[model samples]
Target: MKIIILGAGQVGGTLAENLVDEKNDITIVDTNLDPLRHLQDKFDLRVIQGYGSYPRVLRAAGAENADMLVAVTNSDETNMIACQIAYTIFKTPNRIARIRSHDYDCESEQLFSPEAVPVNHLISPETLVTDSIYQLIEYPGALQVVHFAEGKVSLVAVKVYYNGPLVGNALSSLREHIPHIETRVVAIFRQDQPIDPKGETIIEAGDEVFFMVASQHIHMVISEMQMLEKPYKRIMIVGGGHIGARLAYRLEKDYSVKLIERDRERASELAAQLKYTIVFYGDASDQELLSQEHIEQIDVFIAITNDDEANIMSAMLAKRMGAKKVVALIQRRAYLDLVQGSVIDIAISPQQATISALLRYVRNADIVTVSSLRRGDAEAIEAIAHGDQRNSGVVSRDIGAINLPPGTIIGAIVRNNEVIIANRHHRIEPGDHVIMILTDKKCIVDVEKLFQPINLSL
Candidate 1:
């Protein structure tokens, strides 16, 4: 695919990096030469140094022949305008824009249409990150939670601890532990390496386990692997940025929420906007403020400030001060590696979350959802199997007989709203939503091909 991306910022750059490896033609446009030059040096893609919204710049980036145009500039208006221009002039088939303003309703025809704004899709990173954190709070103790089939099934990642019930047990023993519930262990990560889970594979204390289960049994299955954490009641958020403010708004109804912001005016604005939340006009890293606010009593402490250093300091302080779980938003890979697994419970990369959203549009298969797991080394995809056995490679094939690529596991199957754990004898039927875990993401194209309908005429 010939793609043109606006803004060489974190989101656009990361999207380009992910797509370039998939053999797509990517051209990134930005006013800043430093980031563009950096991306150019790192990836085999074109870089254009100019205003992304400008017509000449879009043309120079080959928007005329491009298959897709992604507008993700800092300004929401710029992104909207770029999409409009791409539709009007170049007739780009797909136009995706990063719209930050909550006021803009993408679904409203009055706002976006081919005759007007012309954006095919809108992605809000803040909203995505907020939803992610909300899901984590909903299912406590799970490191990652991805819902599939409209929340009927869930793929959860949990880190095993010494006290977990299945910590030292073999994979085969899980059935004995939870005989009533049907769950599948998709993949396990040990020492940052993918381990193909087998019957004899024993789970260690530090291993990260990924599994899929029926939505109704999420909490029950989680309890079998790890001692279920008490439902979080008190939540403290550091920073009043878009992500922090949005998260507080979403979580305040269910949890006791407090927000800390450094800027006095911005803090005042947030306090007025939020009805139930307690807004503090002080620095999140300030020890005095944290103590006065009783940070130690908080059940969850989330640091989502723009400053990576401030977030790290505040999260570490909160954890040491007795916060039960600390989740920090860290963008830099170096800082993320440094903080995660030590003091921070979870370090979220906004870029990774953004990239996951972008993958759904780019994937060749009929993928309803795609999640980058194990830090991009692996992926979990939910695809709808189309056609019957006569034309489909997956439909009507037995699980053990399918020619799936190595390192791929059919974790679970959702047929007619029922969750079926993948087994050797389970036969895949048409219209089934198959949930797969691929540790080797490099073979994603091959896996996609296997799920696609075969051309019988050929």
Candidate 2:
């Protein structure tokens, strides 16, 4: 597949990196020479240094015969225009744009039509990150929560604390703990290293465990791994930016929500916009302000300022000042590695979230959804099995018979609204939504091929 990616920033660069390894022709365009040069040096792909929305630049980046055009430049206007050009001149089959502004997104139904802006897909990083944080808040003890099969099933990551119920238990014992609910431990990470979960494998304290279960039974499954946390009621958000404000607006109705914005004007605007949320004009890192608000009573403190340093410092301060949980939005990879699982209970990455949203379109299969996990090193996918035993590798085959790549596990299968926990004897029928976890992303192509319907005419 040939793909022209507009912008060599984090989203485009990471998307290129993910696709380049899968034998795709990737070309990244950017106005900045430094990131373009860095990407060219780091990967086997072409990079053009020019305005992404310019016609000549798209031609230079091989947009004419490109299978897909992804516009993710910082400027929303640039991204939209680039997609329009790709659709108009190049006749690109798929054009995706990263649209940040809610104004554009609200009108997306009409604005993105072929007769209009011509954007085939819209990737909203802020919305994705906000939804991700909302899921974490919904499930108090989960490190990460991602839904599959239209919310019928879920894959949750949770850290095993010391003295947890399942700390010293074998993987096989999970069934005994929760006999009524069906769940599968798909992958486990110990000290940042992937461990192949087996029946005899013992879950140790501090291990990050990934499990798949029905959405309704998520809380029950989480309880077996660790003591389930009380549902969050008091929420505090730092920053009045897109993600923070969106989060506060979404959570205000259900919980006691407060928003802190350093800029007084933005705070006042948020105060007028949100009905249930309390808006304060102050810096998130202000110790005096945090204490005055009674940070100790706050259930969750989320710092989503544009500045990574400020978010890190504020979240750490809130955690130390007695906030039960701290969630920080950290952009830089270095800062994310430093603070994740330390003082910060959850660190959300906008780049990773956007990449996950873009991958489903890039993958070659009947892929319904894709969720990037373990910071882009792994992925969880929901793919529909197509064709029959003669044409598809997965259809009509038992779970144990399919030749899945190393480190790939089939967690569950959703067929006709019924969630079936994966078993070796279970057969995969056509149209079944197969939920799988790939701990090793290098096997992505292999997995895609498995779900792909073979061209019998060839």
Candidate 3:
């Protein structure tokens, strides 16, 4: 597929990198020459330097015959206009835009129609990140929480602790521990290395385990892996930006929430808007302000400021000051890697979240959802099966019979809204939503092809 990505920033660049490897013709557009040159130097794709909304720029970036147009420039207006131009003038088949403003999102139902803005899909980074954080807080102690199959099933990542019941046990023992609930440990990472999970595989302490289970069984499964944390009550958010304000709004009803904003005017606005949250106007990195707010008693401290350095420092300080957990929103790839398991408990990346949202549209076959995990090296895909045994590789085949790529596992299958844990003997029927985990992203094409319908006519 040929894709024209408007914006050379993090989201656009990462999207290009992901698609370029999957044999797609990717062209990135940007007004800045430096980022464009950097992308061209790093990848095997074309880059055009110009205003992404302009017709000349789109033509230069191959928008005329592009399979997809992804407008993810920083400016919401630019992204929306670029998608409109791609549809009105170029008639691009699929048009996606990253819209950040909440005003547009509130009126999206009426605003994004083909007769209006014409965006086929809208990727809201703030919304995605906020949802992700909400999930983490909802299910305490989970490193990552991603839902699939209309929230019937979820894939959760958690670190194995020495005190856990199944820490030193084999993989098969999980059944004995939770006989009533069905779960599958799809992948395991020890010291940053992938481990193939099997019946005899012994789960070790400090290993990051990714498991899939029914949403109701998430708490039980988490408890078996590690000491389940108490429900979060006191929450502090640094940065009254979109993500922070949205998160505070979501959590205020359930948890005691406090929001700190650097800009006094924005802080006052948020204070007026939020009924339950306490808004403070001060620097998030200020020790005095944090101390005054009783940081040590806070259950979760989330720093989501636009500046990566400020977020990192504030989250680290919160951790040192005795916050139970600290989550920082880091955009830079290097900083994300540097602080993953450091003083910061969890580092959320908007780019990764946005990229995950965009990947489903780019994938072949009937892919319902695509989530990037382990820093893009791994992926959890929910694909719908189409065609019968004669025309599809997966349909009418048992779990063990299907030819899956290396480091890939069928975690679960959701058929008719019922969750079924993957078993070797169970047959996959047509229309089943198959949830899979790919430890190696290079095998993505193979997975896509496996789910695709065969051309019986050929």
Candidate 4:
């Protein structure tokens, strides 16, 4: 697909890298020449330097022939105008705009029909990242959860703890203890790529893994991972920015929320705006105040301050104080590399995660759970085992039985809360949800072809 992206900053750059890594034909446009040049030098993509909101810029980036047009510049008005123009003039098939403000236009897509601007998708990185963090806090040991097919079955991530119930276990050994729920541990991010392992392959402590299951069984899956879910009742958010305010609004629907803001005026404003939530006007940087607010009794703690360092520190402190779950909204991916083995519960970047969600939408028709684990085209995917009529020979076999696609892996399967690590003999059933962490771009489409008969559910 030929995609035209407007913005050359962190959001655009990350999206460009992920798209190019997927080997998708990409053209990135920006007003500044430096970031575009940096993108051009970094990846094999066409980068255009011009005013992103202008007609010439859109045309320069080949928007007319583009499969998708994405306006993600930092400026919300600029993005809105650019998308309106693109849809009006270029008639781009899919146009997605990034809206930075917390106040969404809260109307149904059908409501704004006929003469107004039509945006195919509106991505709020802050909302996705913050809400994901909120889910972790509410569900405690969720490991990972990606809602797909419009929130039917969510793909959840879990780490096999060295000391927990799954330690020293093999791919085929899980049924000995747990039963009833058919859970699949789709991919194991051990030594980076998804592995097709033998039954005896032990789950080490450091591997980050993903699983696919019915949305209803989410709590059960967390329990199986030996991490209990603490119902998030009393919550505390350390920032009152867009992420913090929006999260508080969502949380106040069910959970009691208390938000701490350093700025007195903003806190007063937030207190007025968020009538349900308790908005505190104070410094969250001070650990003493956190204790006064009953940090120990709090079910969940969210650190979503604008400062990345502050958010990380606040979340760490919350965890140390015995909070069941702590979430940090740190925007930079660089911080993730150094925090290697630390347990901060969940860490998310708004722009990065929003793009992650967008990429999943981009590959929606063919692939499921398209997430960049850390870097590069190597992705964590839950490919529904679609049986193919085109290929007659590759049937009832594991990754080892057939000449598998390059860089493709069959990670795990849920055959009635049973989590089976992928092995050579394991076969993908019609309803089996397969998680693949594949690097080969062609292998992605090819594997989907093999499992085409199975439901490629939304």
Collision count for each candidate, in order: 0, 0, 0, 20
Alpha carbon lDDT of each predicted model: 0.89, 0.93, 0.93, 0.71
Question: Which of candidates 2 and 4 is the stronger one according to TM-score?
Answer: 2
* lDDT agreement of model 2 with the native: 0.93
Per-residue lDDT of model 2, residues 214-274, tens digit only:
9999999999888989999999999999988889989999999999999989988999999
Query: Model 4's lDDT to the true fold?
Result: 0.71
As for TM-score, the candidate ahead, 1 or 3, is 3
How many Å off is the CA of 364 in candidate 4? 8.3
Writing each residue's lDDT as its tens digit, candidate 4 over 1-458 gives 89998898888998887678666899998889998888888899998888788988888889899899888888887887788788888988888888767544455364223356577777777767766776676556765566654455566767666655666677556555557766566556675556654457676766665655566777777666555656668888889988788889888878888999999999999999896999898876677888888888887788888898988888888778766667777777788655534768667667657776677667633455566554333556665554553332244565577566876666555555445555668865655656655655545556545655544363
lDDT of 3 by residue, 19-71 (tens): 98899999999989999899899999998889999999998888889999999
* Model 3 backbone overlap count: 0
**Deviation of model 2 at 381, angstroms:** 0.7
Candidate 2 regions exceeding 4 Å error are none
For lDDT, candidate 1 versus 2, the one ahead is: 2
Off by over 4 Å in 3: none
lDDT per residue for candidate 1 within 368-442, as digits (tens), equals 999877556788899999988888878999989899999999989999988898897999998999999889877
Q: Output the lDDT of residue 224, model 3.
A: 93
Ranking by lDDT: 2, 3, 1, 4
